[model samples]
Each structure stands twice: as C-alpha cells, then as structure tokens.
Target chain A: MALDDPRATPPPDDPAAREADAARLIGDERLPCGRLVSHAWEQARAAGDQPDPHMDGCAFCRQAVEGLTALDSTTRTLWAERPSARTVADRVMRAVRAEVRLGRMLPLDDPTRELRIAETAAAKVLRRAADRVPGVRAASCRLTPAEGSTRVTIAMTLAVTLDRPLPGRAAEVRRAVAHAAEQELGLAVSTIDLRIASVLEPLKPTASDEPTLRDGSGR
Target chain B: MTAVRTASVERTAARAALAVPGVSELQPSLRQSLAEAATRVRRTLGSAAPSPETGIHAERAPRTGAWHVEVRCVLDEDRRALDTARDVRESVGSAVDAYATRHGIPGPVTVVVTVTRTTGHRPSHHPGTTAP
Candidate 1:
C-alpha cells in the first residue's frame, strides 16, 4: 500500500503498531498461497468478468481468486439447494463410521515375520469352529498368545446336548477347533481348554445329529 | 524420491493383496491415517473412505536397504483369515519384490499382513464338513 493510504500500517519503527497490524492481517481470510482472498475478490467484483492485470500478474492473487470463486459457487449452491440437516448428518456419519476401526491384533505364524490378524476377528472364527460340532454350541471363545511364542491358547465355553458324554463332545469340539486353526487359518493352536457352560435341548433332527456324530459319520 | 518409490510399491502391494482370495477389503493403518488427519489444518477437506493407497505402507531401511511393508485388510468372514492373511503377505511380498527388482531398488522386501476386521457374512457351515 502507498504510505498515504488510510488502511496502511503505521511505520515499522514502532514494533507494537506493526504487531497489531500483523494480528489484524491474520484474522482476515487468506488463500493457500498466503495472499488475502478478499482483495482479489473485490477486484474480481469490480472488473465485471474482465481479468485485471494485477491479479493476472500475481500467482498468489490468481490462486486467491480461484479459491474465492469456489467459495462463491459453493455459497450459491448451498443457498439454492438448502439440503436437509438429515442429509448432511448422514454424509458426516458415513465418513465417521468408515474411520472408526482398528483393534487388538494376533500374530499369524511368526511374530518375527509380522503376519497378524485382528484378535476378535480370529476369535469369532475359532468359536464358529467349535459351534460346528453336532449338539455343541460354543458361547465364549478367547485367544491369548502363549508367552514367548507365536502359538495361541484357546479357552472356550460350550453348551452341548446331554445325548453324548461331555468328554466325547469336548473332544470333537477340540478337534474341530484345532483343525480350523491349523488348516484354515494357519494359526498355531497351543491348547484348546473347554468349559461346558450349559446343556441345551438337542437341536431338531438335522441329518448330522448326535448319533451320526457318535458313529463317526460326521466329518 | 523415497516417497515416490514407497507409494509405487504400496500401490502394487495393495493391488496384489486385494486380488488374493479371502481378502474382502483393505483399510488404512488407523494410527497413520489418524496422524495424517490430525496434522492437517483442514479436517472437512479430507478424502472419503475406502479410497485407494491408504492401507499399505512400504519403507526402505536406510542402512540395510531392506524394504519393510505393512498391510491392513478386512477378510471375508466365510474364508479362513489366517491363511488369507498369509496369502496376502506372500502376494504382497512377491508383488513388491517384482517392483523392487524392476526399479532396481536394493534389499529384500518383507511384508507383514494385518487383518483389521472381517466382512459380516458367514455362510452356514455344512454339518458333516469341517468348518472353514
């Protein structure tokens, strides 16, 4: 600005005055290029679609104008559409939900190798394995890394039908779980400890019933 | 230059991992993505979710020249997660190794695969068949 301009700052000889002007400048809107967007906006408004030489010469000023133009377009758009608050909330919530994740991880084969899986995710798979046994419904399945090794110990609570002996059912579940761990997931099963939580009325005559399972017909 | 190579390798790794069976989807490392979002001055201006180039991080050790890669993914619930992740690790490793070999970047590429979550679908397991 020219020294005479009323909007110009007082001489820099007075540090306090310069600091105050600097503070005011910061409160104003600026483009990514560090130029005041409002000045370029005013020039654009005055030119009435004609490109001005000052803004054309300045990269920062041109950037400011483009940003202001986007803002103006957005303003007109928002005003014209007046979208519902629900729409805005849905959009925001979708983004928030997308980012809401990450949990305890379990190592795959070798801890040194860095292959891992989400702890809960792995647990769910293991639990489902136990649940696959006829008349066995696994309620709780927990996995913890055995100290100093990549192998994991599984502790599960099962509810099985009274038709079969508890030991027999438990053995079946252990086999199923162990097979799943080693074959399907490539997880090392250290030990599968089971707690018979509750006995339930046997599930209605599925072909792979307890008798079939007991006969070793169930795979 | 390091960033460019890392990005290139990460992209290749992501593509390879996605193609592997049982890899339902890929996700950014929560910590890395959070740090990026936090450091930026504008939060609302961020990209939407499930965007490409977020999940895989590949970096070359300055001294050893060994490239360390981390992959985060969501596995298909019906498929085995461990085997899937192992496959992912191998797939990513092989793809990255090829990229390194082509670029003539030094050092072996080692990949660590992480399962972030699994897809919700769990098909009913057949009674006579061993559960997957």
Candidate 2:
C-alpha cells in the first residue's frame, strides 16, 4: 500500500484501545497485509523509526517484528560463527587508495560545466548490465573515455543451456550492456568489445531433489 | 518579518541534493570554495559579509520572488546517476518550500542538478574472481 493511503494505517490514539482492536483483528489473521508488514519491517530495521500509526499497536506487526528480530539474531550468530580476516580492513584501505590514484574522469551530460563520471562507475554500470542477461556473468569490464565517446570492453563467462547457441547468448549480453550504458549514464558507446572468457554448463537437477510427500502424491 | 538569506537557500539546496540516493556529496568548485574562504576571512576582519552560498548558485527572480537553484554533486556507487539527479531536482522544490515555510519566506522554487563526478568500486582486471 502507498504510504499516503489512509487505509494502510490506523489513527494515532490511545495505545491500549488500539492494541485491543489490533488483537481482535490479528486473531483473525487479517490485520496487516504483506506490503504493510514488509514496509514496517524495513523501516524498523533500517532506521528504527516507527512513523506509521498502525505499527504502534498492531499485533500482526508485532509478530512480524518478533520474527525479524529472531532472524536478525540468527544471522548475527551465523556471522559470528564464520572465520574472519584480521587484515581485511588494511587490504580494503590499500585497494581504495589504489583506486583513488587511478581515478580517471569521464565526460558527463553537462555541457556548460566540466562535470565528469569516474571510469570505475562506468565499468560497474557496464558489468552489471552484462550480468543481468540470462546465463551471462561479467568477469571484467574496462572503460576508456576519449574526446567524444567511450570504448567499453567486457569479458563475460557464459552459462548456456545445452539448447541455446553461444553466439546468440553473447549478442544478447552485448546489446543489454550497451543499452544499459546508454540509458543509465547517458553515454554513447563508440565501441563495445565482448570477449567470451569461458563457457559454463548449466547445472542439472539431481534425482535426490524430488519432493518427499507422505500421501504418495507430489502435492 | 525576517528576511531569508541566500546562504540559507544554498544550504537547503545542498542538503536536498545530498539526500538523493546515489549522490556521494556536494562538490563545490575550487573557485566557489576560494570565494567562500575569502568571505570567511573578511568576516573575521569585521567587514560587511558576502553571501554564504557555496556548491550551489541561487538567484531570486526580481519580480516573481521565486528561487532558482543550481547544484553540483558527485555521484557514487549508483550507475543511474542521471535518474538520481532527476529525482534530486524534484526533491529540491519541496525542500526549498519547507525551508521557506519554516523561515516565513514565500513562493515557488526551481532546481537544477549537475553531476561533477561519479565514483564506484573499480572492476578487477583478473580473469577470474571478479564480482558477478
């Protein structure tokens, strides 16, 4: 539901009264809809701000928050269980400093001003666009901006189904990347060189993945 | 009634522009920054203060009392900087309106966003283990 939609939230008033009403509605399991729950949960997780009046006394929201809290705890426990690198921060800082050193700016949309885009941002845009194509994973992307246009070179590893042709998949990825660069960055791609680094086989399902139902029916 | 200064307009514009998701920060030009520094030094010396606008250029229409704002910023991480800048332009009007309402100033405001720089993670040249 839209945030401005009045039906999405209850009026802010006496919490005790609202809670009682929410309890009755929640007993029927129909108080908060999925959209409201998701929005409320995100707001709680991100900013811990409860501006929505319905969140104040809604039992469904309370239950959802409790489940999210439990999930957060479980995720934190899993995170703590993992082995961590002590030098990760130092390595990251070194990499960031290196990137700062190689900061090449690309031309932006503004004609009156000397605004430009970083080459890193352009590469990322191209890479993400190529990766979005089915069965294509972008391995690397390089962007070189000259006087008027940009040259984008991408290396992609493709995972193709046995039925699909290799050339078709590569062409699809190329078009997607070019279109994304044009649409997102307002960049004119003078050249896009796609290198197929590797071809991957699609994963086949195993027999053990079959559903185990008690009544001899898959349902 | 109190008067709203040009500095307040610039601050409001910068805040709204930075609030847009993808905008890394306000990127004031070197000339603008130098001018601001000069104004600061002059203020320290007890002279008539210059307008405190930086990063954004704001001009008021003489007859209409409408504010025209131009903002420069650095884009970060988000590839859709153009779209994000469009969103920032939409936000500026409301931000200026809120500021004006709070300060008892009047009327409609216009905003323009110019992206100065874009920054994101550098793509690795390695044949393997790059981000998928």
Candidate 3:
C-alpha cells in the first residue's frame, strides 16, 4: 500500500515534517552521484510541486526530480481510479488463492511452456471418470506429476460392490480413469495406482443401472 | 528494431486460438489474473482491449527481444484435447507472426497453450461414429 496513499499535502513547510516525509518515501541507498535520491526527491517535494535550490544546479537532483515527478503522477493517477468494490475484492481473493496454492499444478502438455492445470481440477475429472464404472464409486483421487516429465501418475481409492472380482473391477476403474485423463483432458497418464478402499452394497437397479457418462468439465 | 505492443500480440493470439474448434473459452490462470489485477490497480500499462486477452499473456524478452505468448483454455471433451491444443499453438503463433510482420517488429514468436479443463466428453451414450 504505499503505492496509492495520497500525496495531497502541499509540500510540508516545516523542516522536520519535510525530513519525516523523505524518510517515509525514500530508502537509505545513495545515487550514482553520491547523493541520496531520496534527498533530491524530498527537496523537490518540499518545494510544493516545484524544484528547490539544489535541483536547479545538480544533475543528479534534476534526474531524480524527473523520475520522482513521473512516479508521483502515476501514483496520483492510480489513486484517482474508483473501481467497484466487487472488482477489488475479486483481485484480492485471486491473489490470496494464488499465494496459498490449494494444490500442486500439473502440466497439461509441454513441460517447457507455462501450460498447467491445477491438481484439484484434474483430480475432479478423474474422480468422475472412476465413479462412472458400474458398481464403482471413487473415494479419493490424487494426481502427481512424474519427476521431470509432463506425464501424470494417478493414485486413487475406490469403493465398489463385491459382486465382481476385486482385481478385475480395479482394472476397469483404472482404465476408465486413465481414459478420461488422456482423452478428455489431454493429460498424459503415466501410471494409475488404485486401491480398493471399501465394499459398497450391490446396486439394486432402481432407475439407471447402466454406467453413465459425466462430462469432465461439468463439475 | 520496431517496438511491438505486447497487448496487441495477446489480442491477436487470443482471437486466433478461440477461432479453433473445441476451445470453449479462455481461462486465465490464478497467476495471470493476479498479475493483471496488480497492473490495473497500479496503472493501465497500455494493454489491449478488455475481453480478448482475458486468458492470454504476451511479453517480450529483454535480451533477445523475442515474444512469448501463452494461452489457457477450457475445452470440449468431445474433441481430442491434444490435437486441439496443438492447433491452438499453431493458430496463435501464425497470427502473432503476421501481426509482427505487419508492425515491422523483428523477433521470433513462441506460443504455448494449456488446457485447464474439459467438458461434455461423450456425454452419456451414443458412443462412436455411426452411419448417418
């Protein structure tokens, strides 16, 4: 926030106030001219939008003034903008989410490029795919990017009816999940590691007994 | 060397990418959205029109003066995702190339496409192709 804080005061006339403002805005580093750019900026600022005596003769001071004035103008312009509260909140939330990073980002295709899909998003797609298999319900789906590669490895837990062979059902679920990742989302699935987490009561066909398709992007 | 407006390149690339089939809409990454927000809060840094660059980011490299453009999208699952992504890359690259030539900007353009989500994949039945 110092980027948009107002500069409404007519440069403070008191010497102490001027020094305080300079201390707030400028850092300790000196310029190439062996003078603090902050001091040059302060001198110009205290003059009330005009150059002080030092700036009239010093090249370093003049150069500093030029930059400081442009920066001030930019600051004022930014402060002048009155964007909607919703817009500001959206930006803040996006930044916060990005910082927290809910899950690792998995690359979609090219590893060299900046093309990636959030792990959570890809998992959702795979989960839905696994759940579509007859008598199978995906308990958990986790996708991990292979070491130094764009391919992805899937580790999923499935709950399925014990009517069919456990290993066969697991294989079917793996195929469905892998197909969804590669065909639906264009993710190169390296290997699928599946675990039979639980046994669900056999489904008594009530309405739709057949496996149904769920869109990868619907959820 | 002529200076090229980064936004102009982004807009052109976005339009070209969207024109390709299977691209449902542009989806900006969290990082891209945050960067755009920061720039807007600070100052309008001569970016292009509002809508087109929503999911596109274009920047010029300082050393070689080359252009790197990235496009993010949510695609239709019915269409082949990899094929569509490849098409998007080519489409964006060609459009940016033409834009550079027209503007007399000298630099190689690199376009990268990412498919973040896909929907409507073979929706519930009628599996494959059949005689019409």
Candidate 4:
C-alpha cells in the first residue's frame, strides 16, 4: 500500500496519533496526523533553504543573535519560556533597520550646534529665575545669537498688589535678570525686553481689611 | 499757595510711582533710605536757605515748571533693558505732559529711570538644575 493510503500500516505506537489528539483538543483547523507533520517539516526545510537579506543589514537582529549565542547552553533550557528564536530575531532586525535609516538622515554635526546649545541653556536659566520671583504669574525668556553678540528678551505677567508701584517693580526685575545673566552665564546680552503681559489681583486680605474679633479672638 | 500745592502734588506723584511695575520690595526701610539721603543733602546745604524770590530752591524742586518723576525698577532677563528704560521715559513723559495740560503748568517734566537689578529664568538642559 502507498504511504499516503490508510491501508498502509501506521508506525508502531505512532507519535502522530498523540499529536493529532493534542491538535484536536486544541481545536486546530489543520488536518489530522501524518499530513500535518509532513507539511510542517516541508515549511521548516523551505525556510532554511531561503536567503535572509535582513541577516546582514539589521543591527538589532545582530545584537539579539549575539545575545542568544552568548547564552547558547541556557537558551536551550529556556526555549519553551522564550518565543521562537526566529520570530524574536526577525522583530529585532526590523526595528534596528528602521532606526539606522532614520539616524542616517538626521546627521548631528550641524555648524550651529554650539549656538543652539547655548541659546537653549540661556532659556532654561531665565525660565527658572522667573519661577522663583514672587508675584510673577508666568514668564517666558529666550536668548538668540545675533551677528556678533546675543539678544535676550523676557515676557512676564505679574500679580497685582496695591502696595507698590508697577513701573518701579518691573524695573527691579529687569535689573536683577541682567545682573544674573552677566554674572552667571557670562553672555553679552545686547537687549533685555520686558513686557508686563498682565497683572492679577492679590489673594490675601490686607491688614486694614481684617475684621477684629470679639473676646480677643480675631476671627 | 502754588508752592504748597506743588509739594502735595509731588508727594502724590511719588506715591503713584510706587504702583509701577518692577517695584518689588517696597519696605519702610527703602523709604527711610530715600529720606535719609534727602536729609543729608539738606544738612550739607546748612545756612543756604531758599531765597524769597525763588520760593523753593530750583535744585530741590520736584517740578521743572511741570511734573518731575523718578523711577527705580528691576527687570527680567527676557526684557530689553534699554528699550524698557526708553519706554518708561516716554510713558512718564506723556503722563507728565497730560498732567501739565490739565493742571495748567508750563515747565517741562523730567523722568529719571534707574534700573536697580535684573531677574528672570534662563533655559537649562536638565529639568531640576539651573542653567550655568
């Protein structure tokens, strides 16, 4: 009888029967026993025969493979817990290839690199100082490199208080910033533009507005 | 009569100036400092009292035929310090002009702006640390 025919004798104590039973219990859509084994074996052999272009181009895949090779003996024991080696390798390879392509397009060696870095640093310093000043609601500051020097500008909103004059207060803030920039950063700031964007009313009650409580208990 | 009224007006103008932006720490101590400076100047003059014709010494008068204004302020780093100073000058000058027109004063007003300090945030690389 032909091997494909049912009339052919099944292998003694057939492992295929157990595999079929397991597949059935798992509700697999594949056909039973011998055919399933043959199909799977053919696919594995076919995959092994094909060329993988990703193998050469992907750094992540290379790294993963290197990692797996380093854990060669341990990987065998962990094989079931881990995903299939081929699948893991393929995923890593695809990601690394994409990263490499993007990285190449955006080269990090521009001529304005130092200027941009300095401006960024100056902006950070201004932002911090603004946050510390009381009655300052919000602030934004920037430093840009011009032809020979730098220009710094600050915009801020203040909390309204009846106690002091607005113009004088704004002047004080401007002076403080100039001193800080010169002393701290050593930047030659040509201009410092301060704008009083808005003023908010103070929340606390003034001494004159507080009501006296009876029985020496100020309520 | 004009001298007494001008003195009162000058005091009012000084108080109004306290409302301007950049006047952070307005304490009695600062007011005392100004007062002490004025007193020292007066003491140095000694016996040279104001002549009857001038009414008040021209040097000590707050008004130069109109309103006289003085401002002390602090500014942020982001602000153009010189520009702000110029703006203050213009604003005060205009305000004085308007005051002169309404009050029928003939002299020009002078606004002196002294920038005491500068303050503001700077950009930084790290979130927590201040920029160097």
Native contacts recovered by candidate 3, as a share?
0.34
* Candidate 2 interface RMSD value: 14.6
TM-score of the candidate numbered 4? Answer: 0.28
Question: Considering summed lDDT, which 10 consecutive residues are worst modelled in model 1 chain A?
Answer: A1-10
Candidate 2 residues lying further than 4 Å off, grouped into runs, are A1-102, A109-113, A149-163, A207-219, B1-13, B19-79, B86-132
Ranking by DockQ: 1, 3, 2, 4
Best by lDDT: 3
Ranking by TM-score: 1, 3, 2, 4
Off by over 4 Å in 3: A1-91, A94-103, A109-115, A205-219, B1-4, B31-49, B124-132
Residues A1-219 of candidate 1 have per-residue lDDT tens digits of 111222333454665444433323334677665556656655655564565787667777765555545544433344344445665555555545555533356677765747887767777777888877877777787888866778888889877678767777777788888877775566887888999876766545564444223334342
Error of 1 at A200 (Å): 3.6
What lDDT would each prediction earn against the true structure?
A: 0.68, 0.57, 0.70, 0.41
True lDDT of residue A202, candidate 3: 63
Residue pairs in clash, model 1:
none
DockQ, cand. 2 = 0.10
Query: Model 4: which docking level applies?
Result: incorrect
True contacts kept of each: 0.40, 0.17, 0.34, 0.00
DockQ of all models, two decimals each? 0.30, 0.10, 0.20, 0.01
Report the number of the highest-TM-score candidate. Answer: 1
Q: C-alpha displacement of A98 in model 4, angstroms?
A: 19
Higher-lDDT candidate of 1 and 4? 1
Alpha-carbon error at B68 in model 1, in Å?
Answer: 0.4
Stretches of model 4 off by over 4 angstroms after superposition: A1-116, A150-163, A203-219, B1-132
User: Which rank order by lDDT, best down to worst?
Assistant: 3, 1, 2, 4
